[model samples]
Target: MDSVTVEGRAAAELLARKTSLAQTATDALYADMPELTTRYGAVGRERCLEDIRYTIDHLIPAIDLTQPSMFTAYVGWLDDLLRARNVSTREVIRSLELIEQAVRNELAPDEANVVASFLRAGLDSLGAVRREG
Candidate 1:
């Protein structure tokens, strides 16, 4: 296969895996906090999906291949959002670990951190608190 085809396949696989993970996480979150579903309903799901798409489409492309420090900005953004949400740090860590595993397995060397950072940003942005941290 051509290089582009290979990369495309890898990207597609990563997206699929991440989508599955998001679905599973959402299900678990709802199971644990049924009130969240009642309170936010469809809007919450829509926002969550939008966040995922934004990360996959936009933030992933912003990574600097030669400089890992660029990823720190994304990480810090995620940290701030998570802190705002009061999302259990353990849950955030678990989700991040899953995304990192997928990216490490599927992405090219220069792109792995980008995907990881995007996942962090997406999760944080989706359900973060309205108030500042």
Candidate 2:
């Protein structure tokens, strides 16, 4: 009923539709993470898709402006997940960037920004980790 609720719903729907492009995003990701593409194969592909799904299934629902820490935690988990697979934080950042590019290419400006927020958060977390390490 309120604007925030409406915006969240619209952003949620946009993220869901945009996830259908996960495979394309994965291909783009391989440009920077070629080793991962070859090494991971099907598992790598699934992880790429899961990145998109996590934004859709989890972050989008919890995109609350009041509680920003949840978004931060989600992105942290993504970084952890990639590291657990022996992938570098740089690769994870690039993967998130590719997803942002895919969303920008296919959707409206506002919708792209909505989805980009989560992607950017992931990127930021990766940067933080890079700084720490």
Candidate 3:
């Protein structure tokens, strides 16, 4: 087997901390938009947590392979899923931005950059979704 690349190691580290990172991102969302409670109710909070966790789960492979397209593709599917449920695109965008911040803060600088590139791609995809809306 090939030795793990730096990106691979970083991806593994991210996977190891997935739960913590997801919770942190979700907490940030709640802090930034306290009205989420009234707007989305209790299930909304759980959904946010699940979304962050799912995002991180999908992100790990993109980071490991250094493929932004993989992450962006997932973002496209996520955009559709959220839209189907009558969720605001702004919330999706905001949640992604928060996930990026949470990931960046958790990893070392170099590792963070690797992850950030994929995140930027996902964010760009989200931007296009907003524009078309």
The residue-level lDDT of candidate 3 at 108 comes to: 82
Which predicted model would earn the best lDDT?
A: 3
lDDT of 3 by residue, 1-133 (tens): 1126768877887888999999999999999989888988999999989998999988998877778888899988987898898877788788888887897898888778877777888989888877887
Model 2 lDDT, residue 45, Cα: 76
- Clashing pairs for predicted structure model 3, backbone only: none
Q: Decide which is better by lDDT, 1 or 3.
A: 3
Deviating ranges (above 4 Å) for candidate 2:
1-6, 64-67
Per the 3 Å backbone cut-off, how many clashing residue pairs does candidate 1 have? Answer: 0
Clashing pairs in 1: none
Quantify all predictions' global Cα lDDT against the true fold. Answer: 0.50, 0.67, 0.85
User: In angstroms, how far off is 105's CA in candidate 3?
Assistant: 2.1
Model 3 alpha-carbon miss at residue 43, Å: 1.6
TM-score, per-candidate, Cα-based:
0.42, 0.76, 0.91
| Residue 8 in model 3: lDDT | 87
lDDT of 2 at 32: 64
Q: How close is candidate 3 to the true structure, as a TM-score?
A: 0.91
Q: 1-133, model 2: which lDDT tens digit per residue? A: 1245544654555555755667667778776667776788887678777776665455555553424456667777877877887877776677668777887887667767766876677677767877898
lDDT of 1 by residue, 12-49 (tens): 55555656645554555556566656766888756544
